[model samples]
Target: MTTNGECRTNGTRRPKPLLSRSCSENYEINDVDVPGTPKTPRTSTTPGHEKCTFHHDLELDHNPPTREAMLPEMSRSYRLLLESLGENPDRPGLLKTPERAAKAMLFFTKGYDQSLEEVLNDAIFDEDHDEMVVVKDIEMFSMCEHHLVPFYGKVSIGYLPCGKILGLSKLARIVEIYSRRLQVQERLTKQIAVAVTKAVQPAGVAVVVEGVHMCMVMRGVQKINSKTVTSTMLGVFRDDPKTREEFLNLVHSK
Candidate 1:
């Protein structure tokens, strides 16, 4: 019962869809001579097509990568690093080592995703008690900026609050914000002092950082028992010797 460019489907006959070049075009099936394949003479319909044609471009740009996307590149770099060190990355024992190390390295430097303002989160309080409040023996861990090795120990902070005091827990949180990044001890000490000064505008601020840098202890001189101490003194702690001494003495006291 069907006739003249009509097709029957389940006993129904409809006019056939008109096939234009666009509709009939096959995006795949490009008759190009691929680099590794045998070169066939070009057909007129596929003229000037010498390069391989892929269904989609594999280039990446524009968007920021998610943690999952970044992991593969980090793992690849670690594998390349192993190869550079003349170690076989594809060995049975080392097969997943790159992935494990990538995850570990990302965790170690996770502070890059944090901000000082975000960490503070309105932890400042209106207080008129103007005394030297000291927080000492705060555990700190940081990667040395130069060698990307660990430098960990204790941080001691003291500040004379003018009108505002930070919530005690924020002190440790602040230390953690800066300590988790790649840093130099001197810069880290000064950054913590400056952050406290900015947050509370204290009468004075003092910070002392004592660390055993693996960059120094594990390599490059390798002094196994050596320790590095860096300090920052601002405002009264910088100008008044007695205030500085008092802060120092408190930090040093057991």
Candidate 2:
């Protein structure tokens, strides 16, 4: 990590840590460390310039209510944002908009407040079953870190259990914990796989995310039909072609 809080790898700057300290310490979920430039914090509160501060600004902890308490302050920034748009924020129609938007923004990024342990809640159970377990078509919604627009998707997770299995719903809960934050689909997919691996020490884990990013449709290339797919395969899933093919077949099937 650099002094400015970004990551350094192979003499190149990288993006911020993919996982928070609480979650990362337990799960070690981060896998990719691609090159990127360090972003300098800007005081500008204009649209697209403002973002959720979470730990960087507040040294956020596990308690989400603490983050929730910052809503009034967040709303102040939102009020400035409305002013930056040259709109009448005080008008009755927009009078409550700042705080309302603040609530929504904070809720949208609440994944910053979650840790894998909270999601699991001691849900892992010992089982002699060693067959592949698959959960598919888990709906997910997330913010694009780059453009801050929405990317909605479905995630399919699979793991070959060793001595333990997680509660079925906990898989979707894992998806929720990661997808609720500002993210790239690539990291989100890997994080889910890693979290599962850590929870169960599975023989292998596989995750696939199929996302339609609003950023592509609403801006940039304006490619309305574009969808992004990213996947992460660990352990046997990465090493065994047949096993990987089986997981992919399961994920892609209806």
Candidate 3:
């Protein structure tokens, strides 16, 4: 209108007037300072402030936990479990049972932390003698996977080497690798034979395990005197009956 526009200086353009609007009305305005559309403010608390809920709730304490702080909590839980099984946790004989059980369990399952390569490190020797090297009656103790109860007995390993022969103790170490894990006798026997075969590249490898499964003896039929026998044969042992027979005979011998 001329009434408003005429009031401006002759050389200058008149400024636009703002329209009257209610508080409920929303206006479309571009914010050039912002790269894109304007955004509503986030309601979250800032970090590091005492009043910041996220700072208080999400931040972890920097201190490392002490062994003393851990042991009692663990022992209490185990003691509760023993008590739940109808055993007296505070009995004189059972007072240290939790600690003893924890230590024993760690030792029993230590194979999980051990490696076959480390156990057999540099134990292979280059030998010209190609013979059936047998290590027999290796004592083995393992937990049954199904029951988590101990089943233990003996293992016998025999391998005919091509050029490399494992140390006698390495045979026992291989037995220990499978034995330390929760396993079935059949699988353990096969694993030992296979590992020995691969490690030494032997002409043949044979493993026999004789053990009493606690699942069978302690729970199922409860036949205390019964034992389970399993065997695995590889390479020539698998092909030649005579080679297998010799291995069996040697294992059965003293």
Candidate 4:
């Protein structure tokens, strides 16, 4: 007979778990709550946790999601959201709006439906070349967690290979996996860097994102020209200024 609960639930304490998240969603953007816009709440699958190799405060699910199973319920929520905005969802022109909006929302936040391993697809290959690899001007689009609006721009990623390298296109796919979710620019940048690090266990990783947010442009302050830039540097990138400068110089070049 089993005497401990650890064996049944925790199992063998797996290595570099691709699946991880917090027990509660405790972080928030201060002084940004609009008069009517409510914050998005995330559900915790674990008892409580950031449970990853990098231990980021993010939920990276490894299992594929059942999008069809969620459509009906999400569509209903959109119908209610429409009503809250003082609109008649039952009107002929709007009858199908809720369903369409739900589908779009799911597509926008599709990152939650993905896992690092699934997208990597065994693309990592052994290489003797120990040099910096960079992919720049990668198109990125993501939803703002606070207002559920979009922020889009380009991402530039650079990594120092450590006897291994990932496929070139996979760098962009990493951006997509994280950008297609509810995020803030800061967290999104770090998440992209962290994913690249996990993919190849690179000696260092760097990610920079410059974005124009709909939340800032379409509402609250409404500055049409405002843009945000965020970056995450790890390992040699964080330690070596010369190496970091080289990456930045390359990414900024036309």
Q: How many clashes in each structure? A: 0, 0, 0, 3
**Which ranges in model 4 have alpha carbons more than 4 Å from their true place?**
1-65
Ranking the candidates on lDDT from highest down gives 2, 4, 1, 3
Q: List TM-score per model, in order.
A: 0.73, 0.77, 0.69, 0.76
Best by TM-score: 2
- Candidate 4 residue lDDT tens string, 35-134: 1112342234443433322112234342323678778988999999999999999999899998999999989977765667778899999876556799
Which candidate should be chosen as best, given lDDT against the real structure? 2
Score each candidate by Cα lDDT: 0.71, 0.75, 0.66, 0.72
What CA root-mean-square deviation does each model show from the true structure?
Answer: 26.4, 11.3, 29.3, 11.8
Give a tens-digit lDDT track for model 2, residues 171-198. Answer: 9998998898889998888778877876
Poorest lDDT segment (10 consecutive residues) of candidate 2: 33-42
TM-score attained by model 2: 0.77
Best first by TM-score, ranked = 2, 4, 1, 3
After aligning candidate 4 to the native by TM-score, how far in Å is the CA of 38 from where it should be?
A: 27
List, residue by residue over 28-140, the lDDT tens digit for candidate 3. Answer: 11211111111432234324433432211111232223334445656777888899999998899999998877666656755554556777888989776556788898999
